[model samples]
Target: MWYLISYVEEALKYIEANYSEAVTIQDLANWLGLERTYLYRLFNSMVGMSPQAYLLDVRIRQACTLLTHSDLTITNIARSVGYEDSLYFSRLFRRKKGQTPSQYRLTHQSPESNS
Candidate 1:
């Protein structure tokens, strides 16, 4: 059980480092030298979410950071966060965040000075 837990942890670390790229379950399983279905079951049972779901969650969280801290345009931000299509990214952001990216940025942006 502890071995499986460590395996999942390693998988999560890899996912965090490569979430901006097209990381897939098969890729992870191949890298871990485990069967795809077995890895998926272990990961889902331990993490309470599938690998793909976790990847999307990570990507959206990164997008949130870029939205709040950067002045990059929405399209550019979307691309920077591994989204090739800003419209699709906006839709996904709305679904996950309950607001469009632009709306989120506007509401969360730091106050500007009149100077």
Candidate 2:
């Protein structure tokens, strides 16, 4: 892979690895062995978003999966998806999906949701 692309990929991998914990640009940059500003620009240039935004997108994606695939409570699900604050998770979930987590789960997944 190209150097910038590889750095971006490493940033993505770090996000996946530590998604359940608090993450920061410094942490991710250190992991990728790049300076924070460089990594930030690299991600934005390649992916159209900063590292933090990308991580939020990933978190929401995992939350969507858990919301549909598991029977966990919303708060627990939030933690599993890496948001420590349940209310903040709910806000982010709603912002991305336009519905509360409970509502999205009921509407998106049914026994027939397999279809």
Candidate 3:
């Protein structure tokens, strides 16, 4: 049981470190030396989400930080978050954040960054 938890933790770390890349569940499974279905089940059981869901969550969270703090264009932000298609990123961001990336930035941008 403890060993399984450790694997899940390692999976989380891997996603955090490589969320900027085009990572997939198959890649994660290969890295962890587990079958794809097994990794998915373990990750979902431990983290309450599938590996792909967690990856998208991480990417969206990172995008939120970039949007609020940097002047990067929407396209750049999407790419920076591992999304090659800006339109798809926008749709996902909207679904997760309840707003478009631009709107999120407008509302969440730090006052200091306005200087």
The clash number for model 2 is: 0
Q: Which stretches of candidate 1 lie over 4 Å from their true place?
A: 112-115
The runs of at least 3 residues in candidate 2 whose Cα sits more than 4 Å from the true structure, single-residue gaps closed, are 112-115
**Which residue pairs show collisions in model 1?**
none
What TM-score goes with each of the models?
Answer: 0.88, 0.89, 0.96
Worst 10 residues of 2 by lDDT: 106-115
- What does candidate 1's lDDT look like per residue over 1-115, in tens digits? 7899999999999889987776787898899899989988999999999987888899999988878777888998888777889999999999999999989998887654111
* Candidate 1 to native Cα RMSD, angstroms: 2.3
lDDT of 2 by residue, 2-110 (tens): 9878888878888988888888879999888889998888899999999988898888989888888778899998999887899999999999899999999998775
Please report the candidate that would top lDDT against the real structure.
3
For candidate 1, what is the TM-score?
0.88
lDDT on C-alpha atoms for all candidate structures: 0.87, 0.87, 0.94
